[model samples]
Target: AQTVTQSQPEMSVQEAETVTLSCTYDTSESDYYLFWYKQPPSRQMILVIRQEAYKQQNATENRFSVNFQKAAKSFSLKISDSQLGDAAMYFCACRSGSARQLTFGSGTQLTVLP
Candidate 1:
């Protein structure tokens, strides 16, 4: 079984600043994918970043990066140069290599303060 947890229910960051959202997962499967998704007011799930269980290097996409700690089952997302457009509901998700379904966290609403 695999599960994802986001400790913070909400987060706020100043515009043009940075924010880090925390996430943790528990999975018995050795092969899996950890992901951070952002859902805006339109309710579209956009992939922010992803990390493969077997990959030793963390994943980074532009201003979005992840700090993945396999041993501790931690996958945190760092958003640099935050903008108003970045405000959304962020979710941490996990999927086993063999599974088609993704388990997601409750989500953390990000507020970008101008």
Candidate 2:
């Protein structure tokens, strides 16, 4: 079984600043994928980034990057130069090789204060 947990239910960051959203997971599977998804007001789950368990390096896409600590089972998302468009519901998810579905966290709503 795999589970994801996001301790913070909500987070706020100033515009053009940086914010890091924390996430922790427990998975029995050795092969799995960690992901961060952003859902805006339109309710579209956009893939911010993904990190494979076998990969030593973390995954990054533009200003969205992940700090993947496999040993600690921690995967946190860092948003650099936050923008108003970045304000959304962020979800941390895990997908094991055997499962077709992804296990998601409760989610954290990010607010960008101008």
Candidate 3:
């Protein structure tokens, strides 16, 4: 079974700053996928970023980027120039091509202070 882990239960960052959330996973499959999902107060799950195991280069989306260490099974999300809008619950998820389900971590609550 694949499992995602977020050691931090809560984190805070000021507006216009940068924050990095740590995430680690355990998977048996070599071709699995990793994802960072953001859930705001509105309760909508949005994809922040994604990384495919086969890809050597890390995936990035605008101000969001991932530091993916394939050998260590670690995927961390870095929010550059963080804004108040970035304040939300970040969830680390794992999925395989053969499975429809996504294994998510407990979630890290991000509070952006003005």
Alpha-carbon deviation at 85 in model 1, angstroms: 0.4
- Collision count of model 3: 0
Q: What are the per-residue Cα lDDT tens digits for candidate 1 across 23-49?
A: 999999999998999999987889989
Cα lDDT tens digits, model 2, 1-114, are: 888999999999999999999999999999999999999988789999999999999898999999999999999999999999999999999999889999999999999999
What is the per-residue lDDT of model 3 for residues 39-98, given as tens digits with 9 covering 90 to 100?
999778999999999999999999999999988889999999999999999999999878
Best by lDDT: 2
Worst 10 residues of 2 by lDDT: 41-50
In model 2, which runs have C-alpha deviations exceeding 4 angstroms? none
Clashing pairs in 1: none
- Whole-structure CA lDDT of model 1: 0.95
Angstrom error of the Cα, residue 38, model 3: value is 0.3
Compared with the true structure, all predictions reach lDDT values of: 0.95, 0.96, 0.94
